[model samples]
Target: MLRDHLQRYDPVFQHAAIGMALISLQGSFIQVNPVLCELLGYSQQQPDSISQLDHAYQDVLSAVTEFGGSLQSQPLPQGTFELQIQQTAGRQLTVTIHLTLIYDEQVPQYYLAQFENRSLLTETKTQLLSTETMLRDIQDSYQQLLEKMPLAVLITRNGVIQYVNPAALQLVHARDQSEAIGISTDEIVDSSYHYSLSERRKTYYEHQTPLQSITYLINCMDGQQKLVEGFTLLINYDGGPAAVGVFKDITEQREKEEFMMQSEKLTMAGQLAAGIAHEIRNPLTSINGFMKLMRSSDRSSEAYFDIMESELKRIELIVNELLVLSKPQSKHKSQAVDILPVIDQVVTLMDVQATLKNIEILCDKPDSPVQIVGEVNQLKQVFINLLKNGMDAMASSGSIHVMITTNEHEVLISVKDEGSGMTAEQIQQLGQPFYTTKETGTGLGYMITQNIIHNHGGSIQIDSVPDRGTTFTVKLPKLVSVEASSN
Candidate 1:
């Protein structure tokens, strides 16, 4: 009897802060703990003398009864619940309930049971929810600030990317958030080193040892690579362990370092070879000029002049290659445009080839206009690149499907090919510059394509399988002006 007393109603019943009660299926209370009496301002009562679960948890009772068996709340699931119960004086009070379904071990039966204070629980939960909402708002504002930032800001746990800022979109050459989120560093990064880095992070986390400092090569999706030096800290999030790393794109730093090294070499080369290059330029121009003069002098000697002229042009091309080390710059603003016209142009360009191969193209667009903010010429380039790649990937009898969709603030275009697709490894490196699978590829085509899309502030995504085909989806944000907003 003494053992039973302690087991049922001793420490937990008298001392625990939460309300405790046993209520029957018929809607009568079987037991009320001291905490329950204090919560509802009722006197402590005997077992089998209590209030009903229906009064306190009407929604839970209804939902459980309607659904049958036990149920849990959504968005955030918890063993505890929020409820309202009445005091003996007939005032209703709100409470937070830690609930359980008591099952008879011998027979098949479930009894509704719960623990919490009625009045205090409601007030506390209400305040906490308000605070949580405020915090979420601040966090949202912070994310927006980060998104507007030019630097690539990312949040990660271990080596997995949790959140990435807008700058990361351009850095990875990604289409958008869909392509960027949940992407592990190893997947988008060029180096195999990130795999080992991930393994090390895992090991440290498993042993609860925080990562101190690390430096290594990291792959970028843009074919622009980097060597990153970073420090990590361990912290708790949502009652669980997490590692947060704040990092900057080290590519520019590496570029500056390489430029300094190259500047020294170039200075020495200029001193040694400056006279030679200058001397050759004068002779080469004179020789070409004399060749052109000779070609016009006699028709029979035209073939010889042609040979000489070809050599001169070849020399010019070589010189141009040397000068191309300094990249060109372009300045263009995003403008409103319809993408259908761009697709039509690509089809026209590739029409002859498609006809020769007996391939068919299918285009689907809405009857209404689909508009977005982007560079029409640049988006045209993106279309041509994607369409040409698709054409190359497919057989003579293949078919290409183009779909255009529009929402209030964006436009989407998807071009799909029914042809040989890419492997997992190839897919991982598809958008990377200089990472082509083709034999005679310069590997810079996709690199240029990705840059064009970034300039337009649009995203491009490639989805493909091993044998099915490839689909390129581009999303461009629509211009949302005050006039549009008012409408």
Candidate 2:
């Protein structure tokens, strides 16, 4: 009966697609199909045993026995394992073996083993592990590069700081990264910029937009303030959205620029000295004439004394304005300044020069005081430069109109001149260093003017027609009054 049963399955076993083998309970092969011989690079004449094919066969047999199933049991145990075996040519191949026990008449016969080749799967897994390791190494290298870069770098997520490079730590006077991480960005940025920064972050988070480069005042951990110019872009970090900022410390650079501006102011004052002298001479002449009249009469009229006093005061006012322009601004603090008064004072100072050029400066003052926050001297310099430029642009008698207008959020001061005017290309080149339209102009005046306005959170717009005229419109952020703030 056993012989008959074996004969019945012989054809199917011999023609099996995968490697197949039948082994006795003693672990020696009872039958080996042609596929099994070819898979292991063996011939029919070679010795065939389960132990010879797999070194761990004993362990597998032990595991099968530990499952508490006897070889002669009715329901036998079956299992699968992965093993590496050596072919006849000494080459190793990984394979999975499915082993099962067969029975005839409730008695165990032999173990049937089916071998499936898994060399390709094992090789593919190894390649995948290698690729992952390479990617990890690349990430580590980038991290090192970021750590060693000189430019300050900061990373934030959801309005909270997540990482700060060493340079950023130094820039903000932070002792370590832990001091800055996990803190709100508002803690470091100046309060004035909080609203704008918040709005920018919102835009970036919703649309993945980038922030343009701009200067910011950062409050350091050590209570010092630093000026940084930076730009930010959105990036994917750790499987989430983040913002990375690259910055440079510009505090020293700004100080240098301030010194250059101060030097230019002095130079400009020197250029206007002739007009100032002419202005002072009239007042001096008036005082001299009044003194002579007082000396000639035994009882000088009170009007003569009053006239002398008025002339002296006028001289004093001109001298004071010159001194203010010539004096070096070592350290100027920004404060709430009434824009109208500053413009009035500038118009007064430049009026002498304007008259010398036969240019009448007609100032259209606002009914109410327009207020802004800025350095008074710098603000003076801005208008002085503008008014001077207007005077220089005109060749003959013309009016330079100074108009002050205000809105809820900003104050606009327009200096319109009926000069030769400028082409669009010339207007575009207004703020460049050493590029001037005037023959004697240094071109630094407009550049410095633009810089001052920008520092004050303001902007300058120029509109001109070639033959008609040119108008320079300056816009500055308005200072909210106490009442307005409370409201």
Candidate 3:
């Protein structure tokens, strides 16, 4: 009655869902339950008649026996694996058989074994493999994204590469992943850029002065050279001294800058020539007058003198033009001129021409002056050029908005147009000598405007969105007390 009650109350021990077996100290199954018979496809043969020493691998089972016997008292070791057995089935199976040894009264002779079907384990393995495949697919997608990016992405801390994206690897031409990581930038950068990087490192690390908006150099992995301009900042990476830097490969930009630099060299010569021409003009004028007087005195000598005098006068006039290339362009000469008045004046000058195309010129101006420095007339010239550019950019009819603001350090004068703006590549090429977007454009307008502003101590920048619009911003320092005194 007690045995029936035990079987009824604790069915798990007597009639478990899984196979059960009893293993002896000699690496053999002494007995197995009905479930074990079912798991191994065995018939209801007596378990006492079956001994399977070969079913459990002799070596591993021996080790398992050793480890199992040495355990403290009650609980079995978890995460244990062993290869073991079924004699009646006549087939060997790789299984994870869990066993608990019970040692109480009779020489510590009993062991309880649970047999989980290898097929079920196999199915579980297959499900895990599918999940692993999905994880691998996700990793592959992330790798592709890193490879295709246009920007060079690097994660570092105080200039150590914690991470570098594939684009950076391709650009720098690192052979493999091992070559790229934890290597100092000095390894790849040229000797010239090495010093610059050191200075930047000092500024950032020792000084603790952040370089969030710094432009620095990077030598690419390829044999081809580049000046990589980047912005760097300190960030946390799994909580460490993480720095992130994103940069563009600026080899082409540097080439274009070289062209601009050449143009600047030529312009500086023009300034010197203009200064020299001013002194030479007075003497040349007197010399030409005396030659004219000599020509009138003798008829035979007149043509010869006339030719000499004419050539001299021509040279003198050319010198005068050079002198007027700029005038009193002193950075000091400035006035409180409202931008609205200036825009109005420019529109008046080009109103008839703008009307020809049926274009509308719009002005969003504040009542007060967006007052900066320099001459009103000079600023009017800048306004006229920009307005005329806007008008010319449109095909049939379009709008040009002159946006004036007291926005920043300098009064901002913006000329925006609905006409097709330049591409990023084209914008980078703007302000270059003889580099214009227009069919008949000389490309000297912005160059001249830039010079005019420089003479008045200011600068200009352009922003554009292709097929949308272009915005030209003129920033000149506001005329102040020092400027008044200098003038």
Candidate 4:
């Protein structure tokens, strides 16, 4: 029966796909399959000449002897291990070997071994581990950069906040990231802008588009409102799409702008008051003379009273114009203002200044009322800036022509000064902040004027020649009708 069993096992072991071998307890090969010979690059006749198995034999022997003297009393033990082996040509190959002990009549006989080449599998796993480590390093570096950025940054997905950087937390006065994360974007943005923000987010997600720089009023945790200018774009995060917003706090910038505007307004008022001082005094002198004549005479004449009243009204108009220009303005109030009256008032206020400089201001009023929807005070300031710029450009006595013309869609008011004209380069730099041709000019006036015109949905253009003069043409959208303006 043992002979028959050996005959059955020999064919199966010899024809096995994997390398197979049978070794004696003394570590000498009892049988070696053709597959084992090929795997070690050895001839079938040299089964005992496997020098590469020398080191592996020691380990196998040690493992088998661990069961020691009780091997026969206990169940037969099997062991497996991995090692690098040398082929016939000295090439190194990694392999896994499985060892099992065979028992004959309940006595240890030989060891059965199976070998599997793991060189390619080992190389592949090593490459995968290296790639994973590199990716982890890159992610760590990116996270560090985001943490240190000064600009406020946040990430959101499906309109829910996912991340907030330190700057973002400070901007909204949040205690920590936990206070902001998981909150809806609508909760952070002002309620007035919720609809617009929702629509913008919807459009971006639907089309995978990026949002342009826009100003937002953020409702802070501390019940403070902050203005931030930011842009949003879609980014891949954790294998999914998310929106990353980069923002700059513009609240201080806007406040500074308002403060500058107010400063310019005061400066202009001071200049206007100085220029009209004599005009105010002339009327006051006339009224004083009339009062003296009435006090000395027995009775006051109706014509004298009329003259006094007219002089007083003149002083009052001048004072009122000065007050309007110098007063603190309500930044948000706007109405349909007739352009003609605004120009007339500006001309009247500036006329005395022009007269002092020996410059005549000629205003050509339109027959029909040309009206525009804007803040009246801002419009007054716009004209004041233009007229002052015109006056400053002149060296000597010259006329400043103010012309009002209209097209089907817009109204054009041109202030042409017979002063030192500018070059094309100077004209190009007209609206830039802190760029001025005058020795005493702040250069904020034109910039503020340009901002106000743009806010009113209008534009200003300049035409100049070196020796001739400069013309500032302001184009404003014409109000369609009284009813339309009211609506």
Candidate 5:
């Protein structure tokens, strides 16, 4: 009776778009529509039924068999699944397969299977995945550009920072962007510039200036102070007025300008001193010759002539030191000069003075000569001046220790004095022209010494403690030798 009823609808099922098939419990095809044959690339001699031996529909048959087994123990409603079917032309199609069991008085009779194509759904899903990938790439590119920007970028509302890029976090010495977010912008700004910056921010919000530029001092989390040139834009953020600032550090630039100005002033002062020294030295030389003749002519005035001669010699000494200070530094004759021999020569020259003051001179040097490319005479002058100062600092007796050490890139020469040390205030005043600690000392010595070291691309550091002693460490780059490459 069921077969007769199904046969009555054969005309409707034969021409339907969905593929349909009828199969018996023994897995043999009872009947198949033209649509089913076309979908499987079958001829009029289509396969009898679902078969596990066929590769194209093996996956579908396995699922159908499992469904059919479940129908044996209990009645089941229609069920659906999806599978990819390959035709003889090597083309593939995704189809949804629906299965229903036809029972004859509680005994399994046949399975009615239907397949609906799902090719359009697969195409839409593929397009969606490609679009998502493109969007993610665009977002990553935007994030990379922001991180690589040279200037620091900050976005704020009501003085509270809302966003800070990596550059901004680095500018403020923040560990990361999270540390800078939600913090008050005023906290990082230097106190002196707080009111001014705040006022500018207010002006932008009140009138919507759109753009403004200013320079201010900013204090970093690491305790460093910087002068930053900021360009700010007034923008709408989250439906309210906001300020976006881009800052470039200008501290080093400003310092360079000031140094150039100071250099000009020093040049002028040197020219004036040179002229005055020349004018005084000529007259003083003639007076000294006349005093010498008078001392030789009569013993009665000899003692008085001696006193005058000593004062004249002191004046000459001051004039010579002044000339040295006014002289311009030259690097043309620099060579790989051994620092050990130079230090030894300076020690020999000052050894007599040290002995007279009951002081000992000790030297520690490596066996190999420590070499640097610099003016040999200037290096000698530096060691001599520093050693003399150490001798002068010790009133009665003490030892002067000079040590030389070397590393891969540089050489370190340290001069230590066991004498009355200097206070912090006194140390700060060092290297200034016309500033000295000793009554008879001329402050130009240290200033000239530092100038020579700086010209050689070296640096000097002094460590002193009150009532103890002082140590001056000089660091100079070592001369590196290049080995010839083998041909």
Candidate 6:
């Protein structure tokens, strides 16, 4: 009856695309489909045992060690595996086997295994391995090139620094790469330029546009400033949106260019001064002679003559200053000057003007002397100009504070005023030749003060907040006393 049933389904079994089989109690094939025969490269005749088809039957036996003792004592096992089989033509074929066991009356009856080709999957895995190796080598080469770049390279996401190369560490004076990571972009940029830079970045990110190169100032951790030209582009970093920047520091070159421009302006000013002095000297001499004659002719108007003479002297003073400013300086004598006394004298001279405006002038100094090597009168001129400007800034009653503080290597004299102060733009233009705030100001007073302070190997720093006040800080290298130097 089973043979009749098999014969009835024979045509269906033979035509099916998938392999199918039935084995007897001894593991010999009782029925096999044509697909199974073709897949295994077998002839029309069936194999004697299923284990004979598996080249590694010992490995298959090891996989079912729990099937111990007599076959009837253990349950049949089932598993999947990849098997390499030698075909009739002696060529090897790799295939996957899904194997199971059938049972009859609680005893092992037959083994059944289905085979499939695995060559395509194996080739795909090999190609993937080669591609991964190539990708890793390319990434390593890019990392090496980034480290060796001379200009600072930075990668940032959401305004937070992510990666910094060696050159970036050097640019910010950082000790190592760890120091700059996670720092905000604002921290490295100069405060004055921070807002503009942030706004520009926002625009670029919003529009998905690349940033153009810009020259700007950056403040380092060491308190030094650098003029940097920077360029930025959007990038995908570590699978997230980010920006990459490259910077070149140009501080020294910019300073040299500024110095050349200043030099040219000075040369032009000198030539104008020489020509003007020649043209004005003759008229000034004639005016002085007439004023003296008028004073003698009219003794009753002696006060008027004194006033005229004073005005003439004031003109002479301005001309003398211009001549000095234009010419290349000859060496001037230097002396050890105790700046406290000079400051005190200038304060005394300016006190009357302060008093007229209902302003109080307060002076503070250390008990110990503050000494510097400079020209005494020149130092006096610098202080006088600074104090006078402080007074002029005050529209009405306010206090002008002057303090002299000494450090190990320098003396700091700060002049602060409680008055309407300057804006940032005004402060930047303070030292230019004809820049001024007062209606009647020539602007030469501040310029000459700056020149004198520079000549004395000192620096001037100004700080102001609009509607609050202004402070002018003067730093000069301290001169060690002879007794101290000897020690």
By lDDT, the best candidate is 4
- lDDT per model, in order? 0.65, 0.80, 0.68, 0.81, 0.81, 0.77
Q: For residues 338-399, write the lDDT of model 2, one tens digit per residue.
A: 98889989999999998998889999977887889899989998999899888888999999
- Answer with 2 or 6, whichever has the higher lDDT: 2
Instruction: Give the Cα error of residue 76 in candidate 6, in Å.
Output: 4.2
lDDT of 6 by residue, 1-487 (tens): 5476468657866887666565444434556677876766665565553445434234433332322223444454666677675565676667776666655455565545555667668778888999988987987897898899999999999888999999999998999878899998888888888878888787876788878887778888798999999899888888899999999999988999999999998886885566456445655676677677776884546665675676567566566656556544225578888898999999999999899999999999988778899888888888988988988899999899999998779999999998789999999988765467875454667878888888888999999999889999999999888898889
- Give the per-residue Cα lDDT of candidate 3 at 373: 52
Number of the top TM-score candidate? 4
Question: What's model 2's lDDT at 289?
Answer: 87
lDDT of 3 by residue, 223-280 (tens): 5666777877776675676767778777788889998999987896775566456445
Error of 4 at 379 (Å): 19
Residue 187, candidate 3: alpha-carbon lDDT: 68
Give, for candidate 4, the lowest lDDT window spanning 10 residues: 63-72
Question: What C-alpha lDDT does candidate 5 achieve relative to the native structure?
Answer: 0.81
- Residue lDDT tens for model 5, 128-213: 99998997797689668767988899989888998888889888889987888898878888899888977886777677676668
Query: Which residue pairs in candidate 1 have backbone atoms (N, alpha carbon, C) closer than 3 angstroms, thus clashing?
Result: 19-116, 30-48, 94-118, 175-460, 189-219, 190-219
Q: Taking the tens digit of each residue's C-alpha lDDT, what string does model 1 give over 329-401?
A: 1466666776678778877887788777888888888875566666676667677777778888876588888
Structural similarity to truth (TM-score) of each candidate: 0.36, 0.50, 0.38, 0.53, 0.49, 0.46
Q: Which residue pairs in candidate 4 have backbone atoms (N, alpha carbon, C) closer than 3 angstroms, thus clashing?
A: none
Q: Candidate 2: which pairs clash?
A: none
Positional deviation of 110 in candidate 5, in angstroms? 17
TM-score of 1: 0.36
**Clash count, one per candidate:** 6, 0, 7, 0, 0, 0
